[model samples]
Target chain A: MAELNRLWEKRRTDNFQMQLRYWNLIGKNSGLMFVLYAMIIIGGFYYKRWLDGLPEHFPGLLLISVVLSALSVRAPVRTFIQKADQVFLLPVEPELGGYFRSSRIYSFLVQSFVILVAWIVCMPLFFQMAGRNPVAYFLVLAAAFIVKGWNIDCRWQEQSIDDLIPLKILRGAISFLFLYSVTARLFIAVPAACLLIMLLSGAFLFHRQAARGLLKWDRVLDMENKQAMKFLRFANLFTDVPQLKHRIRARKLISSWFPVRSFDREHVYDQIFVKTFLRADDYFGIFARLTIIGMLVSYFIGNGFYTVFIVAATVYLTGLQLLALWKHPLPQALAGMYPVSFGLKRRSFVRLLFALLVIQTVALSAAGAAGMKSPAGFFAFLAAGLVAGGLFSLGYTARRIAKENR
Target chain B: MDPVLSVEHLTGGYSRQRPVLHDVTFDMNPGELVGLVGLNGAGKSTTIKHILGLLDPFEGEIRVAGRTIRQDRLGYRQKLAYVPELPELYEQMTLEEHLQLTAMAYHIDRTTFKERSGRLLKLFRMEKKRHWFPSHFSKGMRQKVMIMCAFLVRPDLYIVDEPFVGLDPIGIQSLLDLMEEMKKQGAAILMSTHILSTAEQYCDKFIILHDGQIAVQGTLEMIKQKFGDSRASLHDIYLAVARGETKWLN
Candidate 1:
């Protein structure tokens, strides 16, 4: 039992460390952060001006209350129970009450941030529309905390029951109504609705506890796994998470472009590489998305030099990311046993990267030429892209691989 | 004729400073099946890694079909097919795609690849799952995919590690039959497994490893005579060897 508590603590610590690492990486990307902060600041200035000159019949209170209530209604409790807990911890189930209670408290504290952020975002509008009363604002905050706590309890109970959709909708509706009443300062309706909600939630909790003493271990573990995977997926965007397994779909329509065919021994890896890049979501999806974004940015920029630069940068990033695919076969023993030379793997990767870059360059140059309405611009962009692709695929990538190997 | 695989005084691991396998040496003859048995952390996998050229040998050398990885890297590797302890597969590749890739890598002719893959898939009862990705497979199914891929190559040597762990009984039977068929066609195999009963039944010889060294290596009769216990089962012999109880024989 003590070990279980330690496990929970460790899970939290590890999650914190992972989040910290990624957050630091994100913070270090100064250009991206600068753009994000600029957008936020610019957006915020216009938003405040818009709020200051708002229409009188905006139903601001109703809108704010409903959104806040909806946000507050989803308070998931992270139990941190893993798949192995079913086998190892099932025998000690009765002694797990304290552990679950602690988990619930931890969940409430972690999830409180959502409620806090929602309230803060709504604060300016509330002051502008509802006439700036700190007492009323504090009351709303207290009421939101109470409602969020109730929702957490209800959701935990809901996990044990089958066919909970109707109950969930009912709870959501009631929460919206209660929040509306409180926010609107309907004194009589507020006390009455609060008491009714409390009574209803208490009864529901009692009924649920009596109906089932056993926690749904499978559901709890599944939810924990999903939550962990969500964190891992987020982390994976910045760096490779070896434990993370990306979901794969056949995407037959996309894969049809690269038909698999028998190749001689020298190009066997080339055939596999092409097939893998076309079929795998990680490689192909990234390539497509980056290429599309590059085209869009190039089209919008209109200046030939800027478009060329954007295309070059996009191609470089795409090539860098695709390097991971080169190491993919390393993890698979059977793939490693392929009689192909290490140099062949590098050649195949460079060939794929060069081909993809060429396609991107051609598309971006065409888009850039159309935007700028200059044949000379198209030729210039095309030359720049080809040079960038050649330099990156042939020189930079090969050097990177060599340095790593050495 | 030269043995298909020969590891002479091979010592290696992931790191150069600390060698996990110390002076490990063994050989597998053509048309032979040798079971490499060991407890966990006893260097069964390390030895396999050395043969597969994933790790550089810290000392000595390994040769496949009389060619060292240095002398003829591609030729050395092309002669062997490996199935690892865990089924390491591309999550994105379907069963059919895995087969296609393996066939291409081994340079199997199109008709031969089609014929071999079809027979292997049906033998493992995985024909219905030809389009299923690794994500959709159970452990047994994934193991079967590895088995199918290895069998598709029909190489001169097969290096299998703990293949029986996740396989169904029928899958195991199919694998055994395929190995036997390959052996009869003059292919050699080095299989690492803890399942003493299956190894005893199928293997022509055994290499019992302890603390990274070959503790004992021979036919059942020869091993029993060396241990001065003519009636000992392979399981008994393995347990005794793992616990260092056969010091007298050593």
Candidate 2:
């Protein structure tokens, strides 16, 4: 293995370890786990119910091919190159082939996991369209994997060439066509052979470019940073990724409601914390989306008793995510420099969180109650959710904040 | 009058087992600009953090206006402001909001805040950009925001670390001019910088920190004489100190 390959391994290992820790943090929250579990079960139940009702005229073949084509063509190539590498590693560019080769293989493997899940998802439709054959499933999957490998390799090479949008469009079309042939036809050997030929030819072209000059370090670094940011943003949905630069939008209407009145010792942290919660990094979005989702689930589940669990679980998850507001901006923020006693901060945060959670409980309860069309169930869910929300925002939160001070 | 800021035998770092700064001590008199000079990782930032009351010193006490941070946390901090090397303005805040927040944090009255912030925005030529978020601003502009926020507090003491790094020439000059004006108004400043030319030209006194200890501290003329040549530049003194680190490495 090249030295750069070892470096890549180290970078990826550290990256995965960081992600694993964040994922574990998200997992440890039992409220979130319950919500996710309920969603998956509901989703699975609906999926089978819908599948059984599929009409004979359903365009299952076209849909599966389009999905598989898109999946295979949309290959993600992550080169764990930090911006600093352009300065330090430029001298050793020629020796970087092994590093990039490892990257492609690793990305192909990682992306394959997603493709496999997608293919398995397409299984029911595929069986309906082309009759049940386990061998055919593997054969079609093998063909799609090969096409995906080619797409990843070609996409990596494409970074070297200046991307006029048309070139990207053309490459996407070419890769999609290859995967389309693999998925569209039940017989796989002909398309498999055809794909291998195209892959070889594609390699030859990129090899000629390599023979002529060094890899475009700037282009590679930019692509890597973008891909890494995409992954981090996705991961941020679960837990705070501190290194990610936050995007702040000034939502004028939403902000108008929570004005920073007087900037005094008593109101400073409260005013700012609420403003940060409402505007900074989609705290409002998470709260609103989770509340709406909880309501929708409760309404549609149509079972008043289960609506209690649904509303409780939803409010809990919403609280858990919104607590990121505290975990993120409150702790790491320069707000620490405020002259006020730190106790004031806790008091303000607790009040803000309780108020927000109370609103979520009311919103979720209204929808849930209306869905059951029973005032009794509505009050029941309202009480249940309020208790859950109150416990989370008060007792649990106060303890958590105190522990942080220690 | 007592020094506006004082540190007595401070020793601490991020980790308790492995201290980075060792017995570092300095003082800042009101209306004087003291330059803190050191190599990278030579405890300049650590020293500034201690002065800001961000980090607790294990072995010593820091005082602003004759009061330790523990004794008067709010009053102690109210007397100080800091400009970090990288502008750490809130991403969500407009330049106007940052000023307001800083003023509010220090409990500045609205009337005073408006007047001060208005003057600051004009002085930095950022009045037009008062409503712009930092994400839209270039490096120099963002740095100007940091400078404006620090000055907004109108603290008795300012702790600035490498304030010139991302600043354009004009922005740098504006900052220098502002520091000069603030000094005349009896505000003390402790600035850490690698730019020897800037320090030698602007600073009234100097502290050369080496390996977390004060290698030397005095006026530029006094430091030059200690180097055994009154005409020798501040650059020469710094290079001589940096070469000591080279000796350690080899």
Best by DockQ: 1
DockQ of each candidate, alpha-carbon based: 0.53, 0.42
In model 2, how large is the Cα lDDT of residue B185? 98
Q: Residues B5-56, candidate 1, lDDT per residue (tens digit)?
A: 9999998888888888888888899999999999999999999988998889
Give the DockQ (C-alpha) for candidate 1: 0.53
- TM-score of chain A, model 2? 0.67
Give candidate 2's whole-model lDDT: 0.81
- Model number with the top TM-score: 1
For A156-246, candidate 2 gives per-residue lDDT tens digits of: 8776765436545655666666666655673667566566656665767654554555467787888787887787787777776776646
What level of docking quality does candidate 2 show?
acceptable
Model 2 chain A weakest 10-residue run by lDDT: A327-336
Please report the interface RMSD of model 1 to 1 decimal.
1.8
